[model samples]
Target chain A: MPRSAHRRPAAGRLRGARGLAGWLFVLPALAFYAVFVLRPIALTLQYSLYDWDGIGPSTWVGAANYGKVFTDPDLFDSLVNAFKLIVFFSAIPVVLGLAIAATIRRIAASRLALVARTVLFLPQVIPLVAAGIAWSWLLASTGVINQLLSLVGLGGVTRAWLGDFATALPAVGMIGAWVLLGLCTLLLLAGMSKIDPALYEAARLDGAGPWREFVSITVPSLRQEIAVCVTVTVIAALASFDIIYIATQGGPGNTTMVPGLQIFYLAFSEREVGTASALAVVLMVLVIACALPIQWFAKDGNK
Target chain B: MARRVRPGRSGAALVIAMGTLAAACAAPGSNSPQPQATGTSAVSKAPACGSAPITMNGYFETGFPLPKALTTEFTKQHPNVTWNVREDQFAVITQNAPRVLADNPPDLMRLPQVSELVKDNLLKNLDGYATAFGWDKWPASQLEQLRLGPGGRPRGEGSLYALGLNMSMTGVFYNKKLAAQIGMTTPPATLAELDEVLAKAKNAGITPIVQFNGGATGGLAFPLQSLMAAYGPTGPINDWIFQKPGATIDTPSNQQAVQHLEKWIKAGYFQKDVNAVDYATMMSRFIDGQGLIMFNGDWESGNLDKQMPGNVGFTLMPPAQQGGKRAAMSAPLAFGIAANAKNADCAAFFLNWVATDKRAREIGVEIGGSRPMGPADAYMPEVAADKVTASTLEAGADIAKDNGAMDFIANATGAIYAKSWTPNLQKLVAGKQTAQGLLTAVQADYARQLEGN
Candidate 1:
């Protein structure tokens, strides 16, 4: 009995040493996360509670900055603009990605399919700032787009895409779509490739059309990828800055103002660091609120 | 697939962390203000720079190229001094000010946010240097623009924190060929005459005014300020800019000025899609003779002289009525010494030399692409080649003599242009709002900004 008890302690010690080794493996990353991520977020949270001009002494205003975030119409408008961007950044990309992925999947082993995928994915590799500048030039009133429209005798329908009050937000959102479509398509294609070909083959043998095969087999397999695409694109859309900054700078009467740009302007330009921090915290909460559900839905797809 | 998802998860985690760090680090209060070490360099003494191996780190705005000759001459005089200069777009300078000034500050930096920098105590007070260097002899109007009150509040009569490298004025630039086509022989002498000229230009199928309202380049704001200067009291306008406790931009004359711009918009005097054009586009359009006139600053004078020499004419925005005092918006390409500068003496020497040195003034006019700080008579030889640049210099000189100059309205606050003026002017041009509505919105924003103080 004494021997068994002593053996139990020895086994426990071995397990404990193994556990310590496991913890040591994770220590570096955890330290990095604590220092870089957690500390900054905590500092941001603390700053949001004050009225800081980014210089001099800061006054602790205590929740007033949060109140400002909730009550300010401009802040709410920025939030609404972000949500509106999701329609372009997430919805349109996923829908178009599915179509592209399905079409390309049929000829996946062909050279033309490879070329098309490469061409479509070109935008993802380009820097967002360069892409923004190119699009701004293309969409300028006297730019090539209008020149083409005039060639087609449709110049009257064209306006400054990024500089008109009514079209600026949608125009910026469309840029987001253009950037995300390729990435989404590639991801969905990866997911579609992993799906058992027998499922589509069976659907086809049962007299299902191509559309039906896509809707049932292709889409069902791509749920996780769609979730991934939605999560990433939604995050990009909400936190968009460089593209919009280079494009319109939220101009034409602040039509394209998003939370990211507003937070930057408030903090850097206006010196209202406190209000900016509050907006930033609110944005993080929003990103979390948005990303968690998509992740959960993505995890559910595995079942 | 797990590999791909793992990278993404880690990427997002880093982004979340980085986003917060970016904000936290940019906050100026993240670090306590370092104790200021004042330099004991007195300009009263003759050139005393020895073989001290003085190193200077300077940051200049992209558009304003630091005069190579100025640095070369300084180096030639002080053979041991070495300069490490960096140039960036003004936006980058403004965005990184907090970080740059908080850590190792450059010896000299272009003051984009003067008020904020002063408030943070990131700038050195130049009173001693100014006194010793005879910078006090410069025009009071010019010197007053650099003066700051306690905590670096702007437009106050206190210790000067910066000095202008050269004068920059915003006025009307007309295409000579287009002006002749419209039967306008000379630049408009009055606001009414300007309107008539615009009408003639429009009838002749030329775009009248090439103004960029898409971004904050003071496209429409300059002309509006000029009109307001014509009718409004200079005291009140200066007070408003100086941020006197009771100052307001909602004066009757100011309202009339904005209303006048609205009328021009209604009359189609500005280019089609005025709000759509940016600064570069408008400048290109005007230079290409697509428009009869451009409302812009003297920064483009060098380019104008280069691109279409003898084709462009320059003049101040004419008075609201005939025989009114000539006025325009004029400030300087201002630079300030950093409080934490290791070589404050070298920085102050540069500022003083730019303002007073003969070769420096010549380079300031010709190579530096800026009007000299001294009167036009000081460097007439340098601008003798470019008529448009000469005309801009003359306009600035006249405005200084008449004491009719005022700072840009956007200068009232760092955020005024981006948050209020540009957007409101765009709204007005789009016909979505009236002049009074614009004033109300701007005043409300201004008050809110002040309340934050």
Candidate 2:
């Protein structure tokens, strides 16, 4: 009993030391969040209740700005387009990533797999605006895309791709998919690597085909990466601004006016800080609604 | 190089601290008293920089070649003035004015459109100082045209705030060959004639017009103003801005003007998706000869001529009806000495020299003119080469005095005007919205904004 009591103080001291180190390591990140993230958000919330013009003293307008923004049909247009992109644009990356990851892990051609990953990730490194500029030229009225389509006897499809309302959002989303391809591939490939290969080997030994083994092993193992990819892509999709701005600036008659673009024009162009801040707040609430449930409960769902 | 000091305005420009009493300085009186505003002969020697160069900050307009060329000439004349120019695509000047005024606003700057500054009390009155400098000789019409104060009243009603660099006149740029190809003897001079041309152009597999209406609805207002001049009466445009007696946007003339724009859109005279083309793309397509005609201003001539590989020509914007009096929108544009400027003397001297001296004429001709105000003498000599631009400027001078030229922010086009008329104008042209439907909505929005303001 005396020896047990003597050991207790040492254990308490060890726990205290670990806790101190953990905080010390995270201190820089915590400081960054306070300065860049928390502070701006707090300031934005305050501004949302005013009729400020990005200058001069703000006048309290109660909830007037919020009411106008919510009732505006233009804001509704942007929100609907954002969801459409998540289903159409964001899903492409997940499917493509899975296929590429499977091929890389199964092919046994290490050099080819390494080269493919490197090339795919190159688009990720291109500055978003520069990348959008490149796409704009490609999809221009007389650019390479039309030329290729013409060769296939699809000349009827030719038009200003980004200028057309029906095709603008889809075309922009496709570019997003192309840009994120590398990041998705790398994440899924990482998950594939972590799955014990012996499970695959055992399945093969029992005369299970490739499809059966992949479903039992790879799919179950990749649930985490899929969640990560969806969450990240959805966030990126919702926050899409630079590409859209540089390309169209939300035109073809407001068809491309995503919420982010709306927020930018409201804050910077029209100088409607109250409305823009409210939009930002609205966006945060939407993102949390979309991402929280899946992350909170589904992290351990796959078994 | 050596620093040069302007004799006349240096004292006024001294950057006294906000705490210092302004009582010692007398407020300058009305500048519209008698002689040339700024002239080379007006340059005097005496005041020099106290210690460091006088610093000037401004929201600079003009892009690429023009800006580069002008800055070179301006810098060569004044070595003591260290200027920092910031470029903005839109009304960045208006947005930045309060910050600049509250926390060390630039000693000198350009505001794209003025009323916002004047309304906010951010500008300085250049009355007595400007008058002493011979700027007072400017005609009564010229002072009123500058709208130095609110309600579109005379500069005499309040303090002089800003001056424009040059005025812009929106005109149509057409392919000389295309007009000839359509077998039209000459370009249309009236709205009905222009319509016939559009119909004929469409029949010939050519787009009738190319516009940046999609890029910014500012262009949309150009045609509307032209219509008021040609189809109905200019009284509504001039007097309605100040809530003056006589006319309003709700008047019959304005409704007719709106109907005319709707007709053009519904008829597909311009491109179908008008909103898709930004200013650059819109002008470039016209310059490329994709469309037979386009509507813009004189400043665009320099821009379009370069983009056009072959040939380009200009004419006054056609009137809305046949045989309508060809009225043109006119306003004042000139340079002014800043009230709080450290080198007020230098700024005044530079502006004065640019206004009247022979050297001013030389510089002004090479560039578009510094004085876009509507007067025969106000034009830069280069306009003499283009008969169309020359005549338009002449016409602009005739009506430049109408209702004191410049309009206010709340009156010209407010948020309601934008929401109701501008966007729907495109849909109307696309044949989606009926003319009456669009105009009714626009009138409602305009009234709402007027009430709110």
Candidate 3:
């Protein structure tokens, strides 16, 4: 018994010694997260409650700020914009990604599939703001896009695409879609690669056709990945700001005034710290509102 | 082998961590944009002509090609001067004033007004330089404006920090050809005259004014300031914005200004979505010649000249209640030295040349692009001709004999105009509320800035 008791400490030490290197390996990452991510999040939550300009002392304001957000028109307009983005990024692109992945996977050369995936994903590599700016010039009032339309004699259709209230929302949302397609295509392609060749062979042996096999085998296998992609894409769509802020600046009236730009206008232009914070909190709440259900599905898919 | 990337229940946790880290690191303002450090070879603080070619640094929004073209002309006259012109957003130069002064400051900046630049004491006193250089060539009105405070500060008594080289008038720019097409003999000379023109234009199916209620650029502030000036004198708006001289909100001019806009709105004097437009889009509409009037600065003349192909015209916007000294916002955009300039004297010499001599006229004609303050018929023949177009250049009288022509930046300059003014007007035009609500919000914003500052 004494020997066994003595062995306990030694055994524990040996086990700990084995894991010690692993713990050390992770410490840098954890420290990085604690410093940048976790700390900033905590600070954001703290600051979101206070009325402070970037300079000078902060004043404490309670839920009164968030309470006011429920009534802000700009907040609601931005939410609608966020919702409008889902059609382009989360719904349509993911389905298209799935199809492209399936088609590319059937190709004999693995390298070609990889190349195709990389090429398809090139848009994601382009800086989104730069892409948005390029698009802005093309879509300007007297730009090439309008010129081309004039060429086709559809001059009436070629209004200032970014400036018009009618088209600004969709035009901005399309940029969000453009940003995500590359990652989606790559991820969906990766998932297709992971589908065991044996399962596909079994489906073929069972006399299943291509569509049947894809639906029965590939679809079930990718459910988890699909869930993940949806969650991520939805989060991304909700968080879209760079494109709108850079291109239109929430113009043609408040038509382009998405929630993100509203936050900026509030903080900078309106200089209402309380209102801006409230709007930010509302944005956070919205992100969570959109994300939580998908998060549940992701968790369930994990199980 | 590197394990495939996964999340949460990840075997390759480091990969996931790195991915997150990369994304987080790549996010907004990750490195936090720092000002580009302009290089400097230190020169004497005291004003003396340098053996090294004086590097005169100036910042303007556009017409960069003009300045580049004038380099040869300037070098011919003063072989020892070279313009190291750094072009960026004017706002960037303003925002970085403290840092620019502390570190390597630009030698000269094309400032909008002396007030904002002078208050911080960033200007070099130009009194001695002007006196020595015999800058008697400047107009009497502009000469009065050149007198700086004790130390070339922007204050009336401040030193002459810089000369007023080029001036852009802010009044009504109307299409005379379009008005003639619509059977109107002349552009509006008064608010009532404007009303009649607006109605006739509306009947003719042209939007009266291209209003960008969304931003502070001449869209909303021009009209709002005009209304305020028209209502009473320009003194109240001045008292509130610059002097803090106890101007009450509830004045007849204030009400009159609000009523004037309301009348215009009821009569459909503006575009359908005036709140929705920006300055660029407004220009597009005006260039298309759909609108009868555009209330912008003198700079728009060059723009209209470039953008509008044929039969375009210009006119100064009439005063709100034009009877007294025809008050318009007479803002003469000027230049100043950085607080900690590496070569203060070189900068001043450059300043003196641009502000005092034939170079002043030449650079004004070339660089300012809108209106040249130097003797007429120099280089920019475009700006020198046409009295209607020239009205904006003429608006910068040293004194406000009446309230109608109060200088927007100096006398009645309101901080709210930069931030709240356009947005408030937009909101009002969007049918959010009355101008009263907008004005109240502006007053509230002023109070906040005052208290917070």
Q: In TM-score terms, which candidate is top? A: 1
Best-fitting candidate, scored by lDDT? 1
Give the poorly placed runs of model 2, Cα more than 4 Å off.
Answer: A1-32, A108-115, A205-214, B1-53, B62-71, B91-97, B127-130, B133-159, B215-221, B238-259, B262-268, B272-274, B304-310, B329-349, B369-422, B442-453
Quote the TM-score that chain A achieves in each candidate: 0.92, 0.88, 0.81
Model 3: how far residue B271 lies from native, Å: 3.8
Using all chains and alpha carbons, the TM-scores for the candidates as numbered come to 0.91, 0.80, 0.69
DockQ of each: 0.33, 0.10, 0.11
Per-residue error at B240 for model 2, in Å? 5.9
Across B387-435, the per-residue lDDT of candidate 3 in tens digits comes to 4334444443322223233456323222345445544565566566586
The model with the greatest DockQ is: 1
Better candidate number, 1 or 3, judged by TM-score: 1
Candidate 2 lDDT over residue span A1-303, tens digit each = 123433556865544454444454555676566556665776677677777655444567878877876787777678777777786456999898888888888864778988888888898899999988899778776779988999899998887677666777787888888888889999999888898989999999999997898788888878888888888888888878878877776655566778898887666545577888888888888888988875865566764
Per-residue lDDT tens digits for candidate 3, residues A1-303, read: 123333555765544454444555676887688668765554555556666543224567767567666664546767787778788768867888888888988883878877887788888888878988887777766779889999999987876676555676777777777677778877877887788899989989999999998899987888878877888898777777788777766654456666777776666544455567667767778789878887787678667
lDDT per prediction?
Answer: 0.80, 0.62, 0.61
Cα-based lDDT at residue B265, candidate 1: 90
Please list the residue runs of candidate 1 whose C-alpha ends up more than 4 Å from where it truly belongs after superposition: A1-21, B1-31, B34-48, B216-218, B374-382
Worst 10 residues of 2 chain B by lDDT: B27-36
Cα deviation in Å at residue B326, candidate 3? 2.0
lDDT of 2 by residue, B1-453 (tens): 232333322332232221133321222111111222432333344323334566656545545334334545766666666667666554454455545654554555655444434444445555544555555565544544444445323232454555544554555678877888898767687778888898999889888888765522435666666665666666556555543433346666666776888777767776754555667777778777789877766665555545563367766666665644555555544344343455655555555555555545455444553233223354356555454445444544544544323342123432433344445654554455575665566556545444433
